[model samples]
Target: MKLALFLVLLTLSMSTRAVLDDCTCLVDCKCKKSLRPGQYYCASPDVDTDSQAIRNCNRDTGTVEVPCYAAPNVSCGGLPYNATQCIFTESRPCTFVNGKRYNYYLAVGLSLFLGMLGVDRFYLGYPAIGLMKLCTMGFFLIGHLLDFLLILLQVVGPADQTGYYAPFYGPLVSRVLVNGTDPFIESSSSCTL
Candidate 1:
């Protein structure tokens, strides 16, 4: 019975005399000196903020106050953080794709002079439609009128190899002299006999 009592007392004394070697157990970690926004702090509580002005008054911890943020006191700039706000900035979901440029003059000329021949359709890139139109002569000219309206509205866009309109160019009369292709082939060539 006496030995049991002595061990209990001995344990209590050892715990009370334990070493407090580092600053870890040190409370009231208020900044000794003022620190700028980006500078580093060496002591237990590394960063100081305007919010920390009142010091640690955490009711749960009584008089001990802990720094609001972690060790690094990087420059986050003043109120209303623009950097974080930029993360939710405007987004352009739909983009306008400029299609291949089809020579406007050449396409228009083909539609006007040889609409029934489907030359315009051929120029724009629809070989099958051009052939059908050529064989039937634009359904006795009714389809020709429709094509003219479609062309004006940009519905009959120049075809790319992918068959999509992308940045079509209207043929400049001056550029014709520069590139120089066979007039007959350009004007009247047909995929079929």
Candidate 2:
């Protein structure tokens, strides 16, 4: 009788234990594929390259349907949230859509330090332009200046094999920098494949 009573108590105690599974899907927008249809991946201001959008695959449609941007504020209370707070500054891992990504800092560094050598173009897979810049000293230095401006303007990001521009600092890297960790890694000895 005592053994059975002890077993019952053990089972009851185990069941009573609290399990916290607070999956904040809306507070932080992230893209994730869902097996079930009608599960929409909604991102505020439209989905961008980065995965900073709500990934709640089960948000009900109609009156109960909550938007990624609107969910956080309404859930947090009646107070309005700052627009900047919604921004996330973490870069998505590479291999995101055919391994297309470029380092923003590297392009800027090359533009500043090696534009005359056309190293930036070479790095960006523009071998012809790189060669021209190399031979003509960055198009007699005019192209070099223009290239620098373009790089800062985000007009000169590396292209994927498909020739689509792959910018390093996109929606993914728009998060607030905390403790020096962001999309563009600064202090890594080896590159992430």
Candidate 3:
């Protein structure tokens, strides 16, 4: 039948020119082809050239790698890239040192509703334990329930220690244990009697 419709329109124009030559666009803005093959859709005039931003096509230096909010000094842990909304996140939420960040849900909502007026130890600056928990009112309440469980288990931070500020959602409380793996899982097999 006419040579099988000319070999099915030359195999659909050679697989649509090899999917438009592997979705070209080496980044100069306005590419747009991504249906999820190699991913391609530029328009990043530093994150708002009309906001397309999908970026991922450097199949051997084809280029497209500048959008961590334009790179330079790229911060997330110390939080600065215009205070983050995510151009690319590894998840850091807070770390600021001298400038101080402090605000894990406003120190657990001022240690759970004003913490017997110690005001969460003066909002975590610890002004002499917030004047001794406002002259023992909170202390009489057992230091306002142990300072609301040590500021909700963040273990009472911020007297310029610079920690809390994480709550984009809730419940973080890390206290460091990264890459951990040796808690006595029992593997001592070496008896050479």
Candidate 4:
């Protein structure tokens, strides 16, 4: 029984390869010799080398679906990105698609204006330290000076729904410096693969 099963599997494998070899592309897109019919594969116009073969391919009157590997760095908001171009900057700033960049002018103005009183820190959700700064005049003397330095460097901001840094100064600065870009657009219509 075991020998029969093994023979059958081997025959099936050989037959599958033969079918793949005979497969032809009906579309005019870039073609790769390694690609077999009923199997999926990626063809890049820019690159000369062929990528890994896809497991399967299926098409219908409405749409042609193939398990094409997603381009790298491409992401759909929080979803995993495939392949997309990304830019990096030194002062990482938060940016959404459609060219919506977060503003830091208000924080800078507030910090410079009331930083001595830790008002900026409070605005950044550090109420505990803000209170301390308010009471002791930013801890006066050495403490005050250090705290002032920290505020000058702009080390504060909003929290997300989870109460974590929704938009913090450090991350913002880093993103700006890196100048990263995500090609995977986030759209209501483009949900779910």
- The best candidate by TM-score is 2
Cα error of candidate 3 at position 7, Å: 39
lDDT of 2 by residue, 142-177 (tens): 999999988777666665532222343343232344
State the weakest 10-residue window (summed lDDT) of model 3. Answer: 31-40
Model 1 Cα lDDT, one tens digit per residue, 1-193: 6576455444532332222122232111232123332232221221124222122232222122222211222322331312111111111111122234355656777888888999899888899989989999897889998998777556566665212222222222211233544332233222222
For candidate 1, what is the TM-score? 0.34
TM-score of each: 0.34, 0.38, 0.26, 0.31
Q: Indicate the worst ten consecutive residues by lDDT in candidate 4.
A: 84-93
**Which stretch of 10 consecutive residues in model 2 shows the poorest summed lDDT?**
57-66
Residue ranges of candidate 1 with Cα displaced over 4 Å:
1-100, 161-193
Alpha carbon deviation, residue 53, candidate 1 (Å): 58
Per-prediction backbone clash count:
18, 7, 0, 33
- Alpha-carbon shift of residue 177 in model 4 (angstroms): 9.8
Tens-digit per-residue lDDT, 1-193, candidate 4: 6576455544544443434333332332232223343223232211112211122211111111222221233322233422221111011112221112223455455566676687756766578887888888767745556655554454443422111122332323322222344233222222233
Candidate 3 per-residue lDDT over residues 1-193, each given as its tens digit = 6576455544543443324323322221211111221121112222112212222422232223322221223333443433112233111112332234566777788787888878888877888888888888888888898889878887778886645656323465543433542232222322222
Model 3, 160: alpha-carbon shift in Å? 7.0
In candidate 2, residue 78 scores what lDDT? 31
Q: Cα RMSD (Å) per model?
A: 30.5, 17.4, 20.8, 18.4
Task: Estimate every model's Cα lDDT from 0 to 1.
Answer: 0.43, 0.47, 0.48, 0.37
